[model samples]
Target: MAASVGRGAPAAGPEAGGALWAEVWALLPGTEEGLTLALSGEVDDCVRPLLRRARGLLYGAEGRPGEEAAAAALRRLGDVLRDYSWEKLNAGPWREISKAWRQVYTYGCLFGALAEVAAGRPLAPAVRLCDMGLLMGASVLDNVLARLVRVLQQHLPREQRRGAAGLAAESVRTEPRPAPAVRPEDALPRLRCPSLEHFRDNYLIPQKPVVLEGIMDHWPCMRKWSVDYFCQVAGCRTVPVELGTRYTDEEWSQKLMTVGDFISQYIVNENSMGYLAQHQLFDQIPELKEDISIPDYCCLGEGEEEHITINAWFGPEGTISPLHQDPQQNFLAQVFGRKYIRLYSPQDSENLYPHESQILHNTSQVDVEDPDLVKFPNFRKAAFQSCILMPGQVLFIPVKYWHYVRSLDVSFSVSFWWS
Candidate 1:
């Protein structure tokens, strides 16, 4: 949107200034009262000089500052502009205007303060002036953001709030049907395949989760990854903290002690969930070995793709795995420890209450062990599959099947998935 006000020109008259102020104020809602306050009596006098300076910067005619000085000024201006708004800084309708201001008027709000501070000039007014500038700038940006959101909403459909195209189409294509109840005894019978080709052709493509018993016996790390040996080899390179928090990324490289601390502190604790995307620990694992062939007992669907993710756990107490479904079939294998899992079928969508957006919400309404049905009325009717996974046991999770996992002991698991 173009500005209604003139650039770097003295207000033609109070009438002209009032017209411009009114035009700007009209962009925002619920601010008529504040606009009125701003226009009463001497308001133009207060806003004129700042507006002139801002206009000068906007036209690419202002003097430049050092890079560090410019960055500090921009950041300070951003903070000041965001503080007066109820929303996050630089979000919504006024984003473009706010961004433009940041670029052009990099040090407009702090030039005097910077000069005074550097020269030890002790200019008391400069401090107050800078603070006031920041507050007013925030107010201006807030109004702009509000307008931007309104404009966007006017042109877009509600479903476009967060792209629901793929998820919606998939849901429609698969008519809701009840899945067969999976029993604990049924878990052991399906642990192996006759050949890798057969497994890939049958199960992997279908996106089913399976548990395989004794597969770890083939892995070199099955014996070497034990907790005691890990503790001995890894000294005090990095200290461990509670789950759901971040730790030093350089710990393992800096000192071998960090690796043991990571396992003991993270793997053994129940109620721990480390966000895989945040720490980037998945990058540290070595690539799949060429000698290791895909197992037959495992299943894959035709023309499907696979994704592998590993999570390390070490707690005797189990972590809370919130109820969620994966897009692809999931195979969860316990490598060195044990965990208890509860599963729910996709047919239970109404009860699970999937998020409206394509991005899933990281929260669940029902608590697995002791659900408060009053809070989640549909939870009592939800169906589930349950099992305990030990080293070498793998569980096959069908596509869109909801499940919650809890570590029963210090354990490690790798999830292989395919679509």
Candidate 2:
């Protein structure tokens, strides 16, 4: 579908510049009134002119003379925005960053989508553009690109949305699910679809950890999620992944890559350990969120429940999360694969040898699997409960309970944390 706009040079003027704005505006629905760009600070100063010039390329009285340049400019503007955003986003101290950086990202996405639209792409490719933007950008701009993409998507058939191939047909690499290295002296209690009152009294109120079964059998993910499924829907979406063994390692660092590439290189090929850990992946990809549901356990409270903090952990076998604890209670749901998890009661914190630094105060210095009895002699006294959390199982971890986790195979887990 060749764009109606011109691909070569055409006349330019103030009229053309203003018309370019109109062109993008007119392409989407319900924008007859107007549209606005949400930009701020220094990043805005650099991005404004690029966007204006790109718009300037779309305007022309005859043949839309600046059309090709407009299309090119839009694509280039997206790249420019990403470069600027990365400069700030990739810097250290991730938890301290604000949404201002993401605003610039939205501009890039909007313009990128505009470029894709101008090129007259098919529905899937166009939707991919919007998906990437949504995955990376903040809620800024008028959502012009998203709106346009939605309009295009209405014509898409349901089969295409679900994908042509099933995940079973496309196993990249299959391997044995690991058996526990050290069998637990004790195992967590499991209840089949326990009632809310029963769970609250036995677990929540008492601050006891338990493995929940039967509640998640209905979740769509149990049947639908697979390597091929992710590649089909989110192959192009970029996600941050931890590199080099684990975060505790001196060489450990994070890198951003498309999910497909991550799956191919780290998951399928087993080049090196790359864990997509502690990311709000559900927020990044809401369509995937539909496959799972928040536990009713999180909703139990006085008047109203606070928002749950959800994170995704996706990686291959042997990925380790060093001993750590969080302030809030956690429901660690195993969507697929198994994880050998060990949990020590908060009373045993002294034996855990927590890091003295404020940043890692909640993290224990002693390795749970291979403790150094000489240096961390107290660790041996810590009593812990353990389990091999399997698919469709949810492990309730009480607040401040010291725990360590190791994946047994390629895995995907979602955690919901609440105060």
Report the number of the highest-TM-score candidate: 2
TM-score per candidate, in order? 0.44, 0.79
Off by over 4 Å in 1: 1-189, 194-209, 232-257, 263-316, 355-359
Steric clash count of candidate 1: 40
lDDT of candidate 2 over 1-419, digit per residue (tens): 22223322322233222444345446543321223454554554666666555444333222232455556666776778767876776676766555777666666676676665565444466556566666666665454545554454444454444343334326655556557754545788888788899999989999999999988889999999987787665565566789866678889998877676677777776667898885557766666788988888877743244367888998888899999998888999999888999999999999999999998899999988888999999999999899999999999999999889998888999998888
Report the alpha-carbon TM-score of model 2 versus the true structure.
0.79
Query: What's the lDDT for all of these models?
Result: 0.42, 0.71
**Pick by lDDT: which candidate is best?**
2
Candidate 1 per-residue lDDT, tens place, 1-419, comes to 22112222212234323443233224533321222212112322433344344333222233434323332332344344323322322455554444334322223333333323222222233333333333323324333422322232222333332122212222211122232244755343355533566555565555444555566567655656544433432221122223442222222121211343344334433243432221112222222222132443433444323334333343333444567776756667666656668777677778866545554553355666778878778887887667777677767777778887765544556665554
Model 1 gets an lDDT of 0.42
Rate residue 144 of model 1 by lDDT.
42
* CA displacement after TM-score superposition, residue 197 of candidate 1 (Å): 6.2
Clashing pairs in 2: 10-65
Model 1, 385: alpha-carbon shift in Å?
A: 1.4
